[model samples]
Target chain A: MSTIANYGEVQRALQTDTEQILAQIPVSPVTLSMPMDGAGPRICASVKRDDTSRVPASVNVVLDGNPVEIVVEAVGDYQDFKAL
Target chain B: MMVNEGSEGRGGDAEHFSRLFEWLNTNADRLLDDPATNLVAVGIGKKSAGRIDDDSPFCITGFVEKKLSEKEIASRSMSLFADAAAAVSNVGQPKSLDFEIDVIETGSRFRARPGLQFPAAQRGLRGGAAPTLDLQKRFETIRKGIGITNPHRSYPASLSVGTLGFFVRDEGGTTFLVSNNHVIADENKARKGDSIVQPGTLDLTQSELNLMPTLAKLRAQLEIAKLSAFVDIHFHNPQAIPFNEVDCAAAEILSDKRDFSEIARIGLGGDLSGVATPFTIDPVTGEVTGLTRVYKAGRTTGWTEGEVTQLAVVTDVRYGAGLARFRNQLGIAASPDNTGPFSRAGDSGSAIVNARQELVGLLFAGSEMQTLANPIQPVLDALSGALGAKALTVI
Candidate 1:
């Protein structure tokens, strides 16, 4: 019985890990460029995610040493995860 | 006489017996009806009640739910309540008993509570819980490093003030010191004969070389190398640094007694020969682009650096005729540091330079990241006109 319980616990842990990894992936939908007053143009990119129930994830876009922009999106549905 | 005594005795006995019988009748009825009444009577008999006299040793055990105004409840009463709560409990029956007292919550409003202890004096009253002389003493060491006379009067480390100098020539050929219009142009225009003092140190006793060694060296090198052969070297008096507008100004030499030779020193870092070092300036538009490191020396924080952030930022500045627009001006923004903005409050009119210490712009207005500096070309032109000298190049 103990071994059976341990197997269930392991499966749940694996499921949680998979969910976290899936949440990190984003699907970008649109991109916009905004000009700064004195600085160069700032680019903003939007992404769609699969897990809509969880908080959105953000990714940093860096080119060379300077920071470019951050792309963020929320996860949507189980079908989207399956498609991924 | 025998009859009289016997009669009086009988009368006294009768009166006593009568009183006892009345008490027994009244108590007997109450005791028979309610067992609690008997306990209350016994308790009352044990306690000496009436009004607690001044001399009486009264040990008040239970709290009083008085329907009195909070004003009526003196500080002494509040203290008594606090003491009572802290004292040993007396309700032997083990049942929880609550006492309520009405207090003023808001204007004309009252609130009641059960078993409420009296409030102590306010926390800040009587210098309670406040930093005393001990705190001042503790920070005395830190205060000395910042040159603060008193810790209590010490301002935050972030605040700073700086001063810059400018010169203006009058019709009499006497070159007078002039700063920003805002500085000298008060309600009444700053006229000739108006007393002007240098903002910071006025002591000329110290060696001008040691005071600004870098500037002195630069001037010496320039004069020796005959760098002034190409550009005119004019000296002037320092004026009051303004708070607003472009911090630009010039001063007149009070006497030729000043060491003009020190003004031409290049190796000392006051050299204007490198003032025209070329940076990325848009040929057609005159807009500054890309990155160029700039430096500035001021009366306050001394020398600091930043990069030119923008060019031709239109800002309205207050002049004699209300607000006037200035265009195509240079704006240099400095990187964040422990001391902040390559410039601060008192750094107005400081000459902004580059890594080579070339004259780049003039330090004026800035807060933290955002700083604005005026290009040196217009300033040099103005100074040249005032000093009766040919215009020098400032890229």
Candidate 2:
């Protein structure tokens, strides 16, 4: 568990992991959220149900040399949300 | 009669709530780290009905993806200051805050409306190929929230349309229509002097015609459809730092001098007519504070309201062929009272404003769960640089 003091470092690690996951599997929408209630320093990788085979079930990020699992949820098909 | 209870207790409660918030802020990471808590976000709000803890009307509001049963919640024994429980007893509130934590379920994914496509048969032949008298009239009366598009695309199938968010005036007194880069500049494929039309190709009602089958015919049609005041769009390049902070662009409004003066004075109007004039940004952070109640007038959804679910959010969004990562974007979700989503397709260029009518963010992207906006300060700064002016003020 990260304290408020070192929360920045934890967030950076999560972002790096998210970037790596996206690079390995293109077009998978991923996001990071603050520890509001359920989890701290978390990243949610949204994968397409059809392209599940291409995406990992979970990703691992090293925090203080300890590995934490980041879950990749299989949402339906990927949607192009920018143009709208 | 209630005044006999005195103000001391009320003041103590207020101070206690503030301290509780401060404590929560300090230990936020630890509380969420424990999966048993099931909290996705936290804030202070009025206690909802049918809660076990009703001693106080106010409590530490905990937003969760799902709510657990009272039995399960109690079994988990979620404590606020477990290590210092003994010391906290001296405080006003109980050491165990499980009863005080209100759990509310909220969907948290950040994306925009999907699979939005118009029929090719309905494509505008009049605007893209040639402008009609009706479209010319619509173009003259430009206003915010009206549909705008880049008629001249590299490919005939490339149809780009979005709402004109706001009218902003630079230091030079040149007013411009603000919107997303993808809407006006066609995701950087459009040049500075490209023709941008009102009512866009999607909004036009004219019947389709494949009149420009040949290159010569295409050029001739382009010439005929070229409504004057060709929009000048410029996308400012990010300096060294990677990732885009904003998805914004400004199109110079080149209406007649008389029309320009009218627009500058009264400002652009549409569904946003009631929005207060003398535009300003959130003064606290030079942008909107988190968890703000906001509303926007857009092309597709018209007018809608929502609350900022989070801020300083990092998310990857799809833009054509590749995924562009956006940093520090605002995540807005439907307000608790409003059942419908905040935005939909064609609402991309709308402006998100607070209740005070201050420009907070530029609506760009979203999904069913969350709508994303770039903080208005960064947007204004970027446009200011691209326009080569000291500053651009929202009018």
Q: lDDT scores for all predictions?
A: 0.34, 0.58
lDDT of 2 by residue, A1-84 (tens): 423213343345543544554554454454543332223333334446566576665555565676555554444444444547
Candidate 1: regions farther than 4 A off: A1-84, B1-162, B165-179, B184-188, B192-195, B199-247, B256-260, B266-270, B277-291, B317-324, B336-338, B385-395
Question: How well docked is model 1, in DockQ terms?
Answer: 0.01
> lDDT tens string, model 2, B1-395?
01112222434666756766776677566556766556676665545434333444445565666566656667777533322222233334443343244455677623566653567886664235332222212344455666777666543555445777887777777777788887777776667766556656565433422644433443333221222122222222354214667887777765542144444343222233323332222422233224377888777776678887554556667666456667667778878876578888888888888776677788989877688988888787788777787987777
Q: What TM-scores does chain A show, candidate by candidate in order?
A: 0.25, 0.48
| Candidate 1 C-alpha lDDT tens digits along B227-260 | 0101111111154211221334343434332332
For candidate 1, give the lDDT: 0.34
Report fnat in order of the candidates: 0.00, 0.40
| Residue B231 local lDDT, model 1 | 19
DockQ of each: 0.01, 0.16
In candidate 2, position B354 carries an lDDT of 75
**Alpha carbon deviation, residue B388, candidate 1 (Å):** 6.1
Candidate 2 C-alpha error for residue B126, in Å: 37
